[model samples]
Target: MAVHPGDSPVHVALRTSDVDEARAFCRKMFYGPLQVNPVGDPAGFAFAGDVVTLGSITVGEISYGADVRVNIADLETAYHVLAPLNGSLWSRHRGTVVIADPTRAAVYRPVGDIDLEWPGDTRLLSVKVERAALERELDAALDQQIVSPLLLGESFDLAEGRGRTWSALVRLLHTELCAEEGLASSPRMAARWRDMVVSGLALTVEHPYGDEPAGLQGPRRPRTVKRTLDAMHAEPWRQFTAADLAAVAGVGVRVLQEAFRQHVGVSPLAYLRRLRLDGVHAELSRSDPWQVNVSEVAYRWGFTHLGRFAGAYRARFGVSPSQTLRERR
Candidate 1:
């Protein structure tokens, strides 16, 4: 997936029962160089294959003949990060253990040699995102090549048991994916699909180098920063202050402040506030105008103070809540 930051999305989906065909696609993508070391002899570990259909948002329609299992090294160098649409995968890379089962989500960087495996039967969706292009997409920490594997490196799983907001983000993407995917027709049919692809990619490939902790990508840890981040995520719109955060994290106010600065790249308040915006965006993105109330939507995301919320919401999203609600219909 050679990416141009502003370039649209390229989506590909494949299901193949033939190991040869699946392996071929993997080879074309990255597994060849990675040289997957299967646990047992191929004849022994191999399971029934799938009826494969390769779908694309870029490069158009490409057909595949069989189901495949593959292994590769230094994936971050080859493929751009493609967000996981469904299912689970187990992989190890970059001295980290990654277990991505979108329901729980496993994301890691394969800086060193890595091992990856696939489920006996799986349906996966991939969107090619070029790091070079992502630089143009936004000014996030992703401007540099993310060595963090799983998200972009060879292939890894999408873990499960994410915090509430992350879970909500998946629900939105899954909804759009199920509704418009089969009828996507062409690569660039509508912005909603593009938004779906981008949003999913951003949330899933979250790296710690920028503002998050070194491994805040998804493993369950009990550090104060981890607890603090999760707490803010749990209550994005809360009127949380630094002192309040320190109490939640069980650290001195200054210590927690420094930790947030070093790990998350932003102050605690800033992180929480941004998450609030994301929360609102997720709600608006998924809300059905015919069924949901607009003001109630704002209030739900902690926008009870109308004017301030409207201004902040408009500034963050480029569109007013009214416009967002109308479009949701």
Candidate 2:
């Protein structure tokens, strides 16, 4: 998927006193249907908020002036992290219920139905992540095949330590997206930021596979390692996740990671990234500087951040990317 210049950092705001209009707006903003009912007099109800789409993730700030109840059959293709900035939200998912207040946030997975209740004067900050992106990041981080949609624990602590860091990152992303012509407007930077959020969530959220053991305990399979490497080099442009490479090798992610470390001297993802960097170097050597920019060439080969790309390029080749481009020019 090529990113258009104006695709990211898109912001939309809606404010209304009608409950039906509020429900419809929520559905349209998040791409899911919802049943919203007022808990009190409809005349006293009001909704106000803005949602910003940054890359594949959507960040929204919403508020309701009166108590309300909402039911959704399924989120289908997205995962949401809902944190209350003020007031409170009671959320139920897969039989577990949690009150998401200032210190506790709710992680809503894509597979199950969701029910939420908002007290009068409640306000929330939400991060909506694409399901595929989240899954791919998790698989890559764990180096294993995830059999189904992730079932995260109900409440996430936001007041201390890891939770605090994660919450801060979200706030930073939200602030940047709301800025005028933010860094998200740059394709490379946007991708890097999006990856940060996805990877951060994978590490922060509590999951069943969080404690999976690493490395092969028995004999290492050389054939499996070779097969995985061959597949990686065959199509370096593809966004190959750990699960994808593991499937190619016919082994689990931990086994694949161990195999590569024993035989290839690097992890599977690292090897793949090295191949991509090499491809970027070769392309830069062949293209004209007059027509090609470093960011364009780097992005073409899946290098998302320009700063990181430059550092890696220099570390690998002992020359900056611009120096290479100058040689070709």
Clashes per candidate, residues 3 or more apart or on different chains: 43, 0
Write model 2 residue lDDT over 96-142, tens digit each, in one string.
68889889999887645679898868888888998888877766544
The true-structure Cα RMSD of candidate 2 reads 17.6
lDDT of each: 0.49, 0.76
How close is every model to the real structure, measured as TM-score?
0.41, 0.62
Candidate 2: give the clashing pairs. Answer: none
The C-alpha RMSD of each candidate to the native structure, in angstroms, is 19.2, 17.6
How far in Å is the alpha carbon of 35 misplaced in model 2?
1.7
Looking at model 2, residue 225 earns an lDDT score of 78
Q: Per-residue alpha-carbon lDDT of model 1 for 1-329, expressed as tens digits? A: 33333333333344544445555655554335634334444453342221221122222112222223345554343233323334545565433455555444443332234455655343333334433333323234232223222223233334442223444543444344444454432334434455444444454454333523243245423388878876776776677778999999998988887876766677777766666666676566556788887688777766668888788877754567777667544
Q: Total clashes, candidate 2?
A: 0
